[model samples]
Target: MVEAVSRNSFKAYDIRGKVPLELNSTVAYRLGRAYTELFQAKKVAVGRDVRHSSPELVKALTEGLLDGGCDVIDIGLCGTEQIYFATFHWQLDGGIMITASHNPQGYNGMKLVRANARPISGDSGLRELEERVVTSAFAEPVGAHRGNVQVCEVMPDYVQHLLSYVDIAAMRPLKVVVNAGNGCAGPVIDALERYLPFSFVKIHHEPDGEFPNGIPNPLLPENRDATAQAVRKHGADVGIAWDGDFDRCFLFDENGDFIEGYYLVGFLAQAFLGRFPGAKIVHDPRLTLNTIEITRQLGGVPVQSKTGHAFIKERMRLEDAIYGGEMSAHHYFRDFAYCDSGMIPWLLVLDIMSREGKTLSELVQERIDRYPCSGEINRRVSSPQVVLESVEKAYAPGGQIDRTDGISVEYANWRFNLRMSNTEPLIRLNVETRGDRKLLQRKTEELLVIIDGFA
Candidate 1:
């Protein structure tokens, strides 16, 4: 007989659930056996974030790994990117990171990576692990080959790796502020500033599992004000913040205005293309026009990909894209094994601003004006598919429609992507126009009505 596993625990890219109930020692033990059997990995590196429940879960996971005849190197209390770093740096057969990644306090999850930092998702290897956990068919080890857990600190070397990507000597002296939101980013940012030519004002720079300033998610409007306020109050040239695990970063202009990730995509796209001319750049389908226009203007190929990191990274590797980005702030680099980094994007942005003698806002303003967007609006509904179907049915007769990731309806003047959230029961709508805010607003409203009508 198979042990029951909660279906809700299997998310789009990872296994995320509330602690103890959905993800506990039993689940970890089963996952360890499944991972070892699936990858045949003899050695694995593990890292965790600064969450209260993380230590206990890490112990449970390590025990399972040992039981499965694998050696585990526990790089204690690090970011998701650091786990990726450890996998490649230490030549481990696989790596796992215990992080909810900007989710609330009670939430905890795992990010698995194959050798060379290759991600393991549901379609790839995660589903197999899930099956093993559900079936409880893990084999017990017979011999005395139990895995040993060793503590290792890789932050210093990881910081050096980050600095290698940017020319710190050429970086002009500038005032910057970083809000880590009391997450794992504080230590990395602290080490990075020590080697840079800029002065930094750090806020919420301590690692507090309590999340005193709410969750570290910068996507929420409420979470951004503090970073913006710090930038303006300190007369800083730029402001940057990261989510809990620091996988995605948010930027603010000198005047404390939050810069949209779409514009940053163009900015970084132009920078990477300038270095590797004619290289392919991949972007999500949500903000196609901006990336398309920028990549064309910069003499590079712009390829549209479906949202989600798994899709973006796979597409990047397939197209040999030098870089990939989404409007939701996930940025992936081919140089980093097509992995998304919350640290690399800001470093490149700062380098661009420093080298060009352009303000952060000035660098991205033209692109923003060229492509005005409605951002992303979420609407709750019982049936997300029904809502998306309704929106598609409403617009399909009059416009060009594509269901690449979601339903994208396009006309000559404007376009919109109405897709259902993979993790939540909601429809995400993003509308953009050539240069008209009014048209964007109108279409956004119409799309909202179509979506709500289904409810």
Candidate 2:
């Protein structure tokens, strides 16, 4: 039986835990068998990130898939999205990427998806996989029917697919800064270089499993300074940095100013709507005044989706939205099989700058001036639910309240979304003001006081 402690790794979306203790070869092997049996998958694509334990995890996972009587397509060391692309592109039944993805070097885990690059979440298949992994649900297969393993490198086609999103000929020769954060993004960037004209200033580009510099989580303010400094030193047009597995990207302007991911929703929606008029756009409920107003101004419908990828993707297909953006740096495109790509957002920003004859700052500066935000503040408390209720009671009377994904309270000039994280024991908050940075700061401080009192 799989250890009861191992189930801690099975989160609302994917698997993640410390290596050799909560997750290891045995857990991966059982997960592989469970995924195969749950989907009755005939063929599965697999890939891995730069984590030290990834190779061993992939090996054991593949063995389990083979023993489950499934054919395996190993796509070699790659980012999480590579497996997503291969699963849909090669018409495989499912896929898994061995990655801890922005976690510390001591951790390792898996990201799984069904055919067509659709996610398998806790409600969908992850819960079942967890139970099976613990119970060893499926019996062993015969040797003759064991699956065969094949290796296929699919980066060429993936690059072409990314480039197809823009008019490459119209792209200007601009100095670009790419901070891979020493994850799996370097190889993909090198592959993409052959097709593009931009000169890249690479930092932390090499894939080192040890992560000597630091864990490659760009969302942390501490992790962002290096990229911002690189942008300033080189006088580049823009700087882009990705997390460990390169699924989400953060951007900085020419002046080394970090652009809030919330503002990008409006900017990208405007860019896409200019071409596909009246197309729908999906946004999370965390911060909405800027997005809703921008979509309306651009003559596009705005749909609010739950804060997770699986929820957003499902909602996108239902609404036929052209794009979706979360404040956490996840940008989903309709053309990219309704999947989020760290690579696509920067490329689109480059295209926007080129086509409009503007710098990255010029493109998003106005949005910043119009709606300044308190970029996702996280606080650990004794009781998250009680804190949430306290904050809601304090402000819900004067503001319009939304409980879509979290408790979002909207007032005339300012708004905030306060909720507990799905995977962590903490209360997360995001506050924004309509062209009033002072108001944003004051409200955020006031809310923090009420929340801290509960804790």
Candidate 3:
């Protein structure tokens, strides 16, 4: 079934494709052999999300790993970060997670990491692995090798690791709505609830691959209403929603308001900077001013990196950054092997609110107002590169331009970033200004007009 599978399954960041067609047991098996051979790995950790196809993929992959003389530590039914945790926390040679992560059901994927949970993306060994998986002659069948496979539970240790981030002694009682969206997050939330003091109103808490309420991507407008409504319905202090694999989480304020990830990056930057004065913090180039301004306000250094987890993590390590945040809700902590963690972000926010006795909105509202931003807007175009070029040319007369990750043109009061998608024929635009929401809106519209005309 996997012989004719599309190479599109091998993405820029990870391997993701629709089940049984583009991705299946045979493909997973081939990938396993290739990964083990490429890394020359002897011992590795394997984890799987709650997708129905995950079990077969996991088994097939493990079989191939075993055939390649690699012993597998299977942390069964885990989120992407759990495998990351196991690989780093246990000092294993490598790890792979079977998950599509917020994609629609019937879609499945894998995320790979080397020791210390360092990401293995396209530019960093994924391409080589892709070639190996296709061209190399993989080894013998499932039971043909002598390598060992062990089933282990790392939840207790993982929860303990999460608890290590904060003191937790001064934490206040806060009613929070946790919407797991029927993914792997439910179990982690349940585990944390037993140790933490907050009252949780759990919604869609099952680890169901059927995904009765639809895929768990909270970034989608349709998916967010449930979490917002739950926050309102429960009269909770905040709402938390996660994707299918729970690597990224979204937040909602007490008034059923969805908090944009961009603002949260600034908020977390401040929190970390306050604690570790003059610490380095890394942010993506898509939206810059708020993060840069806030980090500087507290005598901390703000470094901008190209977008994507692998790139961000690499930069954070290079600078010894205390934290890194993508405006897309993926937060990384220095204490967490410089890898991204969705669970730690919400926990840190709660700790911050409890310490300050301020609402979630109160902590971020000022920053959001000062730098009102046009949250990312994606427009499909026939020639996304042409549209980007046209926008760059139009804005070139006045604003300073940067090609860090995309086309970012800046003025004193307002700026906008236009980046074409790596996997799709779409240009994503983000506009922002200094306390000028109207300017943000107007600039966004002006760019859209240019983009539309080009289209």
Clashes of each: 0, 0, 0
Kindly give the stretch of ten consecutive residues in candidate 1 with the minimal lDDT sum: 1-10
lDDT of 3 by residue, 1-455 (tens): 23453676999999999988888888898888898889988889999998899999999999888888899999999898899999989999999999999887788999999989899998999999888776776655466455799999999999999998766888999999998889999999989988898999999998999998888998888889998988888899999999988889999999989999999898899888878999999999888899999899899999999999999999999999999999988899888889889899999899999999999989888888999988889899999888988888889888898898889999989988889898899889888999997887888888899998855
> What TM-score goes with each of the models?
0.97, 0.98, 0.98
Q: For residues 1-455, could you state the per-residue lDDT of candidate 1 as single tens digits?
A: 66776656777799898887888767777788888888988999999998888888888888888888999988998899999888988889989998888877688889999998888997888887887778866666766878788888888878887887788888999999999999999989877877899899999999999988888998988889999999999999999999989999999999999998988888889889888999999998886888888899878999988888889989998999999999999999887878989999999989988999999988888878888999888888899977877777678998988888888888998998888888888888899999998898888888787777766
Cα displacement (Å) at residue 443, model 2: 0.7
lDDT of 2 at 451: 79
- What overall lDDT goes with each candidate model? 0.87, 0.89, 0.90
Give me the overall lDDT of model 2: 0.89
Lowest-sum lDDT 10-residue window in model 2: 1-10
The sequence of per-residue lDDT tens digits that candidate 2 reaches over residues 231-345 is 9999999999999999999999999888888888888888899989999999999988889998988899999998999999999989989999999999999887788899988
Worst 10 residues of 3 by lDDT: 137-146
lDDT, model 1: 0.87
